[model samples]
Target: MDKKKTLLTLSAVAIGSVIYNYLKPVKSDVEVIQDFDLQKYLGKWYEIARFDFFWEKNLKNVTAEYSMNEDGSVKVKNEGVNITTEKTKTSIGKAKYAGNVNEGALKVSFFGPFYSGYNIVMIDSDYQDALIFGDNLDYIWILSRTKSINEDRKAHYLKYAKDCGYDLSKLKWTVQEG
Candidate 1:
């Protein structure tokens, strides 16, 4: 009986550890922007570059559109073209501020009841460019109001991402269709 009890306790501990790790807020040296203006941020932004991942594999001409939902949540619309298949793909999601609304930290859900962190770490004064980070270091994106960004701005963001421990070699420049 004691042996069975010990096994059960160990199993519970292991499961709990997994859940905690997955649910934990992102711990990183990177900072999240404060005093974020969601109104100005609500619009279409093109993905200038990103870290390649399975979900966005073979995609190009990617763009993310943000709008307000009736229930005070931000609606997210992501669209891209599959270069290999020549098909357009879209994903719709919703985001709510994880912390204060003035902060740029948010929790977004594409799948029902499952949320992930979305942080806007940096933005230009005009709100024309932004640096976005996900729950972990593996997810990062450079976004611009237009389909392409200027060279100087691109270099600045690249440097910042590198300083924050991102792997530049994994960065993929998004193809923008005119």
Candidate 2:
């Protein structure tokens, strides 16, 4: 019985350590964009570049549509087509403007019962392009309304991302075609 208890304790400790490490906060160099104009920021945004993840890998023609909800939250609808499978997936979520509009931060909830932080780190004056950052600073995205971005524009955004302490080399440009 004593041996069993010791084994259980060690197992629990190991599990706890793994969880802590996974949830450990990441240092962010990206500055939250304050004073963002929601009206200008609204509308459809196409994903140009993003960090590759299991759910979104090999996805193309991805876009996010945003509109104001009745409760003053922003409705987020993300859609994409899987190049390999030729299947489409859409995820619906809601985002509430956190604090004042000047903060440029929003709380998004896709899990229905829980909310996550979504901050706008950089945006163009015309709202043509934007760089979005999430909690832990690991999830970053560069978005535009069109399928492609100009060379100069892409370079500019990359530089800004680097300035924000992002691992630019890890960025995966979303393949627009199969």
Candidate 3:
């Protein structure tokens, strides 16, 4: 009887952990950009910089393409080149606005049904540059329409990101060699 009870308790705890992880709310201090226009934002963007992660390790020349799906969801196609092998890698995902369409917060899923936060913290008027944040400080990205961002804009973004509590030291400047 004790063994069965222990097993049940363990299972319950495991399930609860999963639920909490997936449903945790975004940090209160982080704000999503309002007045976002998905139509203008949909296009190819170069990854100017990003926080290093396991999946993108040793990758360079990363680019992301966004397009509207027929069902009103956004289609995300990310491509990167392996620096050592010079081979390209691609991952396709889907995104849906988490709340109001004007808000820049979206739930993105590369793995089906397992959505993660994708918030546009800031975007230029021309949609040529953007700063993105995930649910927490673990994820951050700087993107641009061109391969590189100008020094002034880069400095401004760095300052903004730092002010937002992100550690800029972990940022990996992506190589965009065409």
Candidate 4:
């Protein structure tokens, strides 16, 4: 009888923990701006830094261009030169407001019906720099209007990302030319 009671109590505790975690308000794992103006954000952006990802391996001079689509979704064009192959590669994708248009959270699909989170966590008032993070916290990108950002600004963003529990060591500094 005691063994059965102990097993039941353990099961109850495990279930309780799962429920509590699910009910808790989400934090750092995924944070986005209150409102993101797609029009104001449209244009060219340089990839100053990013976490290592298979799609962009050994790439340099990375750039992303955002354009408005007639269907109300955002068109994304990413271009980069393969350092080893000396060839330019491009990937086109589409993005839509992940939850609501009022939030900076977006769902970007590179493949059909397969979307991933593209949350803009921080952006400068001038729209010159932005910190983009993924919902799973495995992806991160520091983007700028120019090919490079100032050391001060880079340091500030690094600190911000670290505070948010990102592994800064995983970042790959991008090289770009004007």
Q: Which candidate is the best by TM-score?
A: 3
lDDT of 2 by residue, 1-178 (tens): 6999999987887677568547857756456787788888889988999988766788888899999888878999988999878899899999987667777788887764466668888777788888887665567788998878778878887887787778888898886653
Q: 1 or 3, which is superior by TM-score?
A: 3
TM-score of each: 0.85, 0.81, 0.86, 0.82
Give stretches of model 1 more than 4 Å off: 1-26
lDDT of 1 at 131: 91
Candidate 4, 23-72: lDDT as tens digits? 64344575687768777789999999999788899999999999989999
- Give the total clashing residue pairs for model 2: 1
lDDT tens readout by residue for model 1, 80-172: 999989999999999999989899898998866667778899889889999998888778899999998889988988898888888789998
| Alpha-carbon shift of residue 26 in model 4 (angstroms) | 11
Better of 3 and 4 by lDDT: 3
The C-alpha lDDT values of all candidates are 0.88, 0.80, 0.90, 0.86
Q: TM-score of predicted model 4?
A: 0.82
lDDT (0-100) at residue 123 of candidate 1? 89
> Candidate 3 has which clashing residue pairs, if any?
none
Q: What is the lDDT of candidate 3?
A: 0.90
